[model samples]
Target chain A: MSEFFSMGGYGSYIWGSYAITAIAMIALLLATLRSLRNSRIERDQLETVLQARRPRRTKKAPKAS
Target chain B: MHRFAKPSVFLKLTDPLLPWLAGATAILIATGLYFALFASPLDYQQGDTVRIMYLHVPAAWMGLFCYVGMAICGAMSLIWKHPLADICARATAPIGATFTALCLITGSLWGEPMWGTWWVWDARLTSMLILLFLYLGYIALVNAFDDPERGSKAGSALALVGAINVPIVKFSVDWWNTLHQPASIVRMDGPSVDPSMQLPLALMILGFTCYYFVLLILRVRLELNERRIRALQLSGMFDERSDQEAEKANSYDAGHNAEASQ
Candidate 1:
């Protein structure tokens, strides 16, 4: 276990490369997901506002029986 | 092909694909890591430090691939004026930049231990650095203008221009004496590395490719949604402006009626 972690004395270099790659990829994924969520929220809000502003249609009254 | 260029259709088509792509990426990466760390034998030359190649090489490849993808999208946007192409190019910039950054940082990390230096301004390294700058420049140019269309146009042109660096980065080692080694896997003579190493490398490349697509689809969706919101706001502004005009006209008529009665 310790030997595996040590990586024959080049452990720091190997681990550093992997760690940075992992961090960058995760960061990008999170940022992309967050942006998607935010955009969806904004779109929904705008759509709702537009729907509310639209003029409501009226129904005609029935003739006297 | 052109049919999917519509943002609405694009969103519909890619919505179903994201889950599969993400799942494949996760599986591939896990397998690749397993193979890289445990199964692959130590290099007789570099020892365990060669493990860095698994991540470093794939990232460098992806950085180049993404730039090429961006350039193609830029061309489509510029020449044919494909609507989604610009958005795709825009979506690709940041992702490519990140990949390029990863490549550089990992390369540096690998270099420090192997070459006994942190960095060298060699042909390959310098060209890759230029690629990173190109990605940054495209991102900045795309958002610099008030008119999004104009910004996209400018960015597309810049991307097209910067594409010359891609080939330079690829062939830099062969063209000049550099601290970085020349191509090993992608040669006419075939890959020089052991089969064990190649498997993990291939898996890592595929995994990274999957991740790129997943992010690209998400970013493109966000771009489309943002555009929709902008259009909605603009329409709403137009509606409000017309309403104000109608109100002003009504007041003017009311005043005229009152004066005539007086």
Candidate 2:
């Protein structure tokens, strides 16, 4: 509603507070997710290298007389 | 439950959850802010200043909620050594502190017009301020020690001590006559607030809760991976040493065979 945005005259202060809070929350969320993604990628790389280094097992043959 | 505490399992479970939680948080916050800002009716008495309550109240609630959450996780970390518990406590601290900070700032913003001043040393505000300090102290103590385990144990003790402050913060208005209004939104009898205003308030609270969960899950995921990386680093070192030993043993065996052949 037009009246809602007008806020009967205190709109700036009230909405300002909400805006700042929301922005802060969003920033925190983004930072957290970004770092999490980086860590996950790093871990995956480590796991892959470790796996590659592991020796592959092969079956051995036996001869009968 | 304890089995899920394994880092690999936690990482896999959280892998899918991270994006979902983040998406949920964004939707909740956008809708909540829309409702809070555009849909809700202005207060009859306090007019627009009452809008400040949307951020202040939910943030205050989360400030308390987060500390309680941290305390429980810290206790679990200390007793059972739940690998994720200490990390949870660590991750939640900054978010809690931010909410507490928001509460104080918005409380000041609300007070300036309504109370004719920015702050008063009233019971409610005083207790809430102390709660903020408690959060900061816990965060500082937890990171002070060189050893992670030592820091965690010490932080756990601080968190337990700080839990006592939560009740004091909640009940301070009732325990004493104060400039701050008593519980208007959450009460045994029912919220004294208008229904029009209540809806937006409820939305904001839900949004804030979702935001907290989003952050918690993301942070915990990072922490679990960090632990895994640490383990991997140690394993890498062990692998290098084992490889060197194997190479040395093979060289020694080859030399012995060659000597026999000669």
Candidate 3:
């Protein structure tokens, strides 16, 4: 309703405050999620490369009884 | 406490907590918004403008709470050299800075209509501005050095010293004549605000607190992964160098054998 939206002529201030709060919160959530994802990818890539570089150990032959 | 100091154990415990905290935050914020917009009665003096208090006050509270939390973590890291404490303190800086910014912006928006001014250098406002600067400074100091340990040490020291501002910000209105009003919700007498208003305010504060935890867990995990990556890379570099040295020695031996046979 227009009445609710108007907030008795204090609509701009009320809406502005809520909007800014929402934006800031959303932005923070997105940034944190993105950073987490990026770091995970980077860690995975590094792990794979390190695994490939690792030297394989050969099995020892059994001794004659 | 010591059990969780290992990042792997900390992650295992907190990974399960993140979804639950995030869910609670969503529910609480929704309920708070409903009450704030529809259920709460308009203030007799400030009218609908008082609605802004639900957002502004909670954010300001969170800003202070996060800073205090960061300072405590800093102290723990400094005294005991707790590995996870400095990471926690580092992770907290940006979240606290965001909340402080939200508080300042919302307060300014609320002020323009109520006080007929966008800003004023009153005791409370100035102290809050200083708090924002402190958070920014802490974040910058933490990342300024090539050695992350040195950066953490410097940042922890700064956080401990800057903690003096937290109490100042809290008591500024009482200490000096300021345009900002004295404490209403937290006081010796009790909350002066109406029960209807208090409900939404409490909900919002709790929602924000849960939200902070959710973000903290995520950021801490990111920091741990970063440290792991750095360690792996360094070890990988050392391995490559040793392999090259072995190859060089073998080639030299082969050439020496050829010269002897000739």
Better structure of 1 and 2 per DockQ:
1
Give per-residue CA lDDT, model 1, range B1-262, as digits (tens). 3455567688778888989999999999999999999999999989999999999899999999999999999999998888789889999999999999999999998899889998999999999999999999999999999998899999999999999999899899999999999999989899998898999999999999999999999999888888888889998887676556666877999999999999
Candidate 3: give its CA RMSD in angstroms.
Answer: 5.3
True contacts kept of 3: 0.88
Put down candidate 2 lDDT per residue, B1-262, tens digits, no spaces. 3465686676677778767776776777677777776777767778778879888999999999999999999899988888578889998998998899899988888888788898999988988888888889988997798677898899989998889988888888899999999988668999998888787778778778877887887787777788778888788777765656767877889999999999
**What DockQ number belongs to candidate 1?**
0.77
Question: What's the TM-score of candidate 1 when only chain A is evaluated?
Answer: 0.81
Winner by DockQ: 1
- Worst lDDT 10-window in candidate 2 chain A: A56-65
TM-score of chain A of 2: 0.70
**Per-residue error (Å), model 1, residue B24:** 0.9
Candidate 3's residue-wise lDDT over A1-65, tens digit each?
99999998999999999999999999998998898899899999999887876743111112211
* Candidate 3 pairs with clashing backbones: none
Over the stretch A1-65, how does candidate 1's per-residue lDDT look in tens digits? 99999999988889989998999999999998998999999999988887777653111112211
On a 0 to 100 scale, what is the lDDT of residue B6 in model 1?
Answer: 65
Give the DockQ (2 decimals) of all models: 0.77, 0.60, 0.77
